[model samples]
Target: MRSAADRETAPAQGAAGWYEAADEPELVEHGAVTGLAVTGQGEPGGAAYNESAGALYAVMGALGAPMVPLEGRWWVEDARSPFEVPREEWRWHLFLRLPDGTATIDAARAEVCSGLPAAARVQHVSYTDGRCVQVLHLGPYSDEPASLARMESLMKAEGLVPHGLHHEVYLSDPREEDPAKMRTILRQPVR
Candidate 1:
């Protein structure tokens, strides 16, 4: 028999694994997750992205859910490599995971519409990345290409092909943390 307190502190089913990745490239399978999300097209750290993020945080804070790390799914419209595409052209869905049994979307929407009009664009969304290749990326965001290249090499060696958007779980706040000490989980869904 487990105590209620113990159950309360336990991670939700599959939640613990979702945010973890090895320093070296490896395969992982993520279960379906539900959360609040807002989509936009802009370079990370640009005005549009920052505004959207602020809105998301405001709504989440209003809901009183425990803060979770921010996550992003990114892609580009151009056929060229995402790296080659202009930063301003990047499309992204920013996500904040809601705790299990959190308030309904209607309530969240109402909260948004009432005082946080900017968050009106936020929506309740769910997704399953399924099988993926992920690795822990350390240092500044600019150095992520090397980590991504390593993940790509592992994927190729394992006969995997990318099947979903490029994903990142931000484990450090760039505004407060040292760029050299930033940690991010880079994930790529694959088939």
Candidate 2:
């Protein structure tokens, strides 16, 4: 994997550029990625979200891996838009990508124990995102809908339909960056 900065010059599939609504959505093919995952239902940036994130980093540290930015897959029941659901009812699979060759869950757990509130709930998993339509959302999370709409419009124009939950890659830490300058990659698996 390349640093986000390096990705800008790499390729569309690898570019880490923050896109605007006027920018065209890109279709990228991704291979399988391994990571530590935790599932929860509630508004993001809340206690449950924090604890799960802490546990993931704790496990990653145990495996001697560098701390990676957080990512998440989000969804709701009945095909309702995630925005249509109340924050308290949102469901998410939050995860951190593990470095290649990281130790197995059992092996890492034996060496370092996590005391985070959601530590026991963590799981190691791998999945292929396959084909996706993605755009860079460059502002506060609250403005994601605009980015998503543009992607959806592009997907529809291309005769593609969503194949899985919506995904987000946090490129800038909201804690340190101003909300107006935050960068996030918004992706939706598509066929």
Candidate 3:
């Protein structure tokens, strides 16, 4: 029989395979990687949903914990980032609804980040609303394939269908944690 370890490291959509962490995570303030925009929910110049959703998860990094399904608004305009890895994988990304004439996404992020701590990383934000279910996944990122399978099974059993994009909140930086023992949250938005 396959163990959890084998499932997580498996490739997922040509990227990191589905995985989960299994512990209560903590929270803290994080910075950078943000954007600004009017939340589609009707707030002018409000943050976009799904943009900078990683910020909340990043806080878990400060608390030595991980989070999942961070649904929020975010994005940065026209700014290539050094922190971002070049890949097609889903990011705990921020969404930003920009003005018709906004020059770049980074500019939007700067507008929103100004309200936050001076050191806050500017990122884009997007706005969205719907039923979303979340859970805390603990352990190595490699083991999440099984975890995701399990979550999918639960969703099926509950008669819930996936509605939006999946998300992961990285808690322990691989550089700091034992790869054999990592922490992250796997989330599937469903209805």
Error of 3 at 27 (Å): 21
What is the lDDT of every predicted structure here?
0.84, 0.74, 0.39
- Order of models, best TM-score first: 1, 2, 3
Tens digit per residue, CA lDDT, model 1, 1-191: 23323322213238777778889887777878989999999999999999889888888887888888999999999999989999999999999998766657777667767776778898888888888888999989889999999988877776679999999999888564587779999999888
Residue 60 accuracy (lDDT) in model 2: 79
Which 10 consecutive positions of candidate 2 have the poorest summed lDDT?
13-22
Tens digits of per-residue lDDT for model 3 on 149-176? 6776656655667666554555555334
Best by lDDT: 1
TM-scores, each model vs. reference: 0.89, 0.84, 0.40
* Tens digit of per-residue lDDT, candidate 2, span 58-90: 877877777777899988875676687788888
Name the lDDT of candidate 2: 0.74
- Top candidate (TM-score): 1
Instruction: Report the candidate with higher TM-score, 1 versus 2.
Output: 1
Q: Positional deviation of 172 in candidate 1, in angstroms?
A: 0.4
**Higher lDDT: candidate 1 or 3?**
1
Displacement of residue 31 (Cα, Å) in model 2 is 0.8
Worst 10 residues of 1 by lDDT: 4-13
